[model samples]
Target: MRKRFVMLTSASAGALMLALAAPAMAAPEADTIVTFDVTAGSLDITAPAGPVDLGDGAPGSTITNQLGVVAVSDTRGGATSVWDATVYSTAFTNGALTIPVGAVSYWSGDSLPGSETGGGTFTPGQPTTDDQVPLTGTAITAIPAFSHSGGTGGSTASWNPTLVVRVPITAQLGTYTGTVTHQVA
Candidate 1:
């Protein structure tokens, strides 16, 4: 009985020693990196597609017309975006007959009904008829500098201008055509 007991104790002690000496099972893990990119935007402008026609008037009279809608779009997604719109005109001519560019006047009346949108400060070059400026061969500010202060994404502004042409008393009796150009920067 003693010998049997001694053998049983030896087997139990060997099993306990093996369990303690074995390596423990561990959880495995790995690391991964993540990434992405963002592209830049731009600023643009647009003008009326149709021609602006000032109705006919007798010699030594003035003809006036609306210059349609002109718009500026700033899509640069900038917090402090600024832009200016300039305008110039060529001499009105009918063959040899010419009407001087200085005789043309421009008035940036106001923004069209519900045409002004987004957030920014829009200032017309000519705020009123009294403030009309003479149109010369050289470009002048049609829409003065616009400053985007409290806005997000993009901003836009649009306005209708008035054109006044004074006919000289000695002007010829024919249709006079001139080109008016608008640019933004």
Candidate 2:
């Protein structure tokens, strides 16, 4: 009976030791992970529909323009934003994106008090000042503007504006490209 009792006690002790040592076993192995995201994109600004029919009256004549969505956002209420607009020329890959080639015969204010064909009415993509380009001067006459939303509930702000440019027919006779840039401060 004593021998059986000792055997039971030893077995019980062994079982207890194993139960306490189980947690000390090291985990199988470690793992590795990697991640990535996207930002910035190429923009395509089209001369909005109702493009001046090339043969209706005069191709690229009596010109001025207004491009909508002057700017865009990727995230909801993102602090940073992108602005865009299309011009008569599809590509202004000129050393810069905007060019100067003519004289501004007239200037128009923002408030449009008359009809679309009236004077003093702001043409979003035309010169706002009646500027003249000298034989040795720049030709970009008007500069447009960009309005960026601050946040979900904040007032928006205007970014770099477009330069009003004059393109006198007598200046050149071929398709010309222009470019201008705006850096946020």
Instruction: Score each candidate by Cα lDDT.
Output: 0.76, 0.32
What lDDT tens digits, residue by residue, belong to model 2 across residues 41-107? Answer: 4322222243222121122344343322222222322243333222222222234432343321222
RMSD (Å) per prediction: 6.8, 12.2
Clashes of 2: 19
TM-scores of all candidate predictions against the true structure: 0.71, 0.28
Provide the global lDDT of candidate 2 against the true structure.
Answer: 0.32
Report the alpha-carbon TM-score of model 2 versus the true structure: 0.28
- Residues 1-185, model 1: lDDT tens digits: 99999999999999999999999977697778878654547767677766656789989999988877778787776666567777888899999999998888988766666765667666778878898877868564343422234566567778878888889998989999888877777
Please give the RMSD of candidate 2 to the true structure: 12.2
List residue ranges in candidate 2 displaced over 4 A.
1-5, 13-44, 48-55, 58-79, 82-139, 143-185
Q: Which has the greatest TM-score?
A: 1
- How far out, in Å, is residue 49 in model 1? 3.2
The superposed Cα distance between candidate 2 and the true structure at residue 87, in angstroms, equals 4.4
